[model samples]
Target: MTAKFIVIEGLEGAGKSTAIALCQQFLTSQQIEFINVREPGGTPLAESLRDIVKAEHQESVASETELLLMYAARSQLVHNIIRPALAKGKWVLGDRHDLSSQAYQGGGRGIDRTTLQTLSAMVLKGLQPDLTIYLDIDPVIGLARAKGRGTLDRIEQEAVSFFERTRARYLELAESDERIKTVNANQDIAAVHRDITQVLEYFFQGLN
Candidate 1:
């Protein structure tokens, strides 16, 4: 099988972690060689950027600054981790990717979509996930789940309206993209996994 990149994207508390774990198990069962990674992470420099982005800063972080930092981190992860793993014929499973920036910065922060697209094209250089599993959920419920888990991070602490916009962008993009598969994460855990399993099976069938 050709090496493929799979990404899971969604708002906070959308069960991305659990979905990723499920993918890992599925890949393991199929004896597929794969590496799991998270956006703004999976590399030393990228991890640092993740910290800065998530940290509560005394000085307000400018939207442009945050956008640049996200690209920088993505550049590192793509160059140092994702591409290399794919080159070695290993599948790459990601917790998030370019779409997150489009939704969070472009939609939530109300940045220009063209700017975000230009940055993504430059940094990614045509690289894109073979499959993107988008866990869809209401912002209100998702935010509540996140709050119940623990203290929210800088991005997670954004207003509910911000997430509402983010979710809207996510759905809009997913609907237009053939590579993206939208799953109803509002369903019970087992039901969600069953749907994910169905998606993966269909994707695998297409691969063959």
Candidate 2:
């Protein structure tokens, strides 16, 4: 079977980590070889970019600048890690991808869609996730969960309204894209995992 790229996307504290773990288990059970990576990371340079993007800065960071930095990191990750793994016939699982940018930067930051599309076209170079599982949750609940983990990052520190816009955008895009699957993440942990299993099994069947 040809290798596939899968991604998990969600707002902060939407249980993406848990969902990703479930996906990993599912893949392992199927005896599939895969590598997992996170966006703005997976390579030395990209990891550095991740730090810059996450760290609080004295000066306000421009939205456009943040968008550009994200794409640069994504470019490095795609060329150096993602594509290479797929070429070696290993499935690639991503913690986040360009859709995060489209939702966060475009919807939350109100950046121009044209700019985002241009950057994505340049970096992705026709590559896109074969499947994306978007864990959906209310911003209020998600933010409370994020706070429990510790201090919030720069992006996570944004107002709840920001995440509301981001969530709206996520749902809008997910509805329009068949490759993106929405999974309710507000349920009990076990219930969420069960839903994730169903999503994965459906995706696997499609593969055959």
Candidate 3:
């Protein structure tokens, strides 16, 4: 089977890291070489952008500035890292991708969808994930889980309502896109992993 790009997406505390680890294990079992990538990161310049974007600042960050920074970081990762890795016959497991922008910037920040689409078209140039798994969770529960980890980042510091909007958008997009699957992250960790594994198994079977 050809190498495919897979993305794991969710709001804070949705267990994306654990899900990514599971994906790695699954790929390893299949003997498929893969690379794990985190959005707004995965490259030197992109990682720098990530730090800037996530850091809390004295001044309020404009929605436009936040949106542009996300795309800029994404452009660097896709062109410099993701595309190259895929070209070399390696699969990519992404922590987040364009969908995050749609949910966070568009839904949460109220950015216009047309602007996002234009930016995405310019930056991605038709590249897209072969499959995406969205771990769905309520903002209240997810934020509590995230807070338990450590200090919340700038984005994570957003109000619970912001995440509500974000989660709604995630579900909306997932329902519309067959390539994206939604897994209930409110369940126990093992159950979430089982659901993810089942989704991956179904996808891999289709590839045959």
Each model's TM-score, in the order given? 0.99, 0.99, 0.99
In order, candidate lDDTs are 0.95, 0.95, 0.95
Candidate 2 residue-wise lDDT, 1-208, digit = tens? 9999999999999998988888999999999999999987889999999999999999999999999899999999999999999999999999999999999999999998898999999999999999999999999999999999999999999999999999999999999999999999999988988888998999999988
Tens digit of lDDT per residue, candidate 3, span 6-92?
Answer: 999999999999999999999999999999899989899999999999999899989999999999999999999899999999999
Residue clash pairs of candidate 3? none
Span of 10 residues, lowest total lDDT, candidate 1: 35-44
Candidate 2 root-mean-square deviation in Å: 0.6
Q: Relative to the unseen true structure, what is the C-alpha lDDT of residue 180 in candidate 3, on a scale of 0 to 100?
A: 97
What's the distance in Å from true for residue 144, model 2?
A: 0.4
